[model samples]
Target: MSDAASRLAEVETNIAEAARRAGRKAGDVCLIAVSKTHDADAIRPLIAAGQRHFGENRVQEAAAKWPALRGEAPDVTLHLIGQLQSNKAEEAVALFDAIHSVDRSSLVQALAKACDKLGKRPQLFVQVNIGDEEQKGGCAVADLAALLAEAKAAGLAIDGLMAIPPADVEPAPYFALLDELAERHGLPLRSMGMSGDYEKAVMLGATHVRVGTALFGARD
Candidate 1:
């Protein structure tokens, strides 16, 4: 197997083991190969090795890289996993199959308008600032419900909630809190976890783990 394939296998094995320990099946958790910053050349190997779901952080970068690559590999799924600008809503809606960073009512309105304009409704995940940190790119925890309501009022389909915990502190509580929020709001997806703490996220009922370095190695 190629190096990327080998690494991909290892990550999958780790995810499976984590799921088993949590008494859940591995398939319950979706692994999103975070392909931001890395060029299409860096991503093709993983796709060739059967990695379908990939994430990119920027609309411009994703637009630049994915179309041609996707033409060659039509089944690849693209996710927008970063803060989105209101002006770029139409482009994002056109490009990504899922967007994991819908954080505010303004963004919700923009996405709703874009979806209407384009006649497509990509899956939307409401990003919560689980840590309540000042510099983060998510709706404050206290504001999540209102945002969801806003999305609903705007006729946007909200799939679930996504979060990033405070760096270096325990993430389990944050993951648990996000899972609880999803449950209370009747949402289905929980976009939590990263390279270091995905196992913990899985144990606490995360449905999607955004793993980067584990699959792609260290970024530049």
Candidate 2:
């Protein structure tokens, strides 16, 4: 098998094992192969390997490659996993099947407007600044309820909560915290973990794990 396909299979195995550890079925967890900064050539192999869900960090970058890639694999689902600027909401809505970073009220409003104008509503995840890190793009933990309320009031459907724990630290607590928050708010999905920590995240009830490096190797 090709290297990329081999890597994809291993990651799937890991995800299945982790899901089993968590007493959950593997099919219940969505493995989102984060394809940010990679071109179509890099992504096609995984698609051929049956990886239907992928993620990108920017709307323009995703637009540059995914249109053609999806043309080849119409079953592929694209997710916007990076922080989104309000002005890019229209383009992001048009391009991605799901968005994992709806973190603030203004962006929520912009997305609502875009969805209304375009007549398409992608699955939305309200990001929580679970670590309260200033450099991050998520809404403050204290602000989460308010932000989610604003999103609902704007007529946007919030599918779940997404978060990145403070880097270089043990992520279990943060993953557990995100799980608690999701349960508290009755959200069914939790988008947490990257390649480094996805197993822990799945064990902690993550419905979606944004895996990149493990599937694609280190970025250039």
Candidate 3:
């Protein structure tokens, strides 16, 4: 196998083992190969190796990179895994298949309008500031319910919840908290975890793990 394919395989194996330990099927967890910053040359091998879901952090970056790549590999599902600006909602709605960072009502309104105008509704995930971090782009835990209600009122369907725990800490508690919040709010998917702690996240009920470095190697 190519190096990228080998790395992808290892991460998949690790996800499977983590799922088994949690008594969940590996198929239940979607591994999103985060392709942000990496060029098409860096991503093609993983797609060739059967990776269908990928995550990108910026709409502009993805817009520049993915169209041609998708023309070649039409089955790939792109995910927006970063904070989105209200003004860019239309482009984002038209580009991504799933958006993992819907965190506010203004964004909700923008996305709803964009979807209506474009006649397309991508799967949405309400991001939570689970760690209560100030610098992150997520709805405060206290405000999540209201945001969800507002999104629903705006005609946007939210499929899941997403979060990033505080850096340099044990993420288990935060992952568990996100899972519990998802359950309480009737959200079925939980997008949590990244390269370093994805296994822990899988065991803690992460339905989707955004893995980049582990699969693509260190970025430049």
TM-score of each: 0.98, 0.98, 0.99
Tens-digit lDDT track for model 2 on 61-128? Answer: 99999999999999999999999999999999999999999998889999999999999999999989
Residue-pair clashes per candidate: 0, 0, 0
Residue range 1-220, candidate 1, lDDT tens digits: 9989998999899889999999999999999999999988899999999999999999999999999999999998899999999999999999999999999878999999999999999989999999989999999988887888889999999998999999989999999999999999999999999999988999999999999999999987
Candidate number with greatest TM-score? 3
**Candidate 1 pairs with clashing backbones:** none
For candidate 3, write residues 111-174 as lDDT tens digits: 9999999999999999999998888999999999999999989999999999999999999999
Q: Candidate 1 vs candidate 3: which has greater TM-score?
A: 3
Superposed by TM-score, candidate 2 places the C-alpha of residue 108 at a distance from the truth, in angstroms, of 0.9
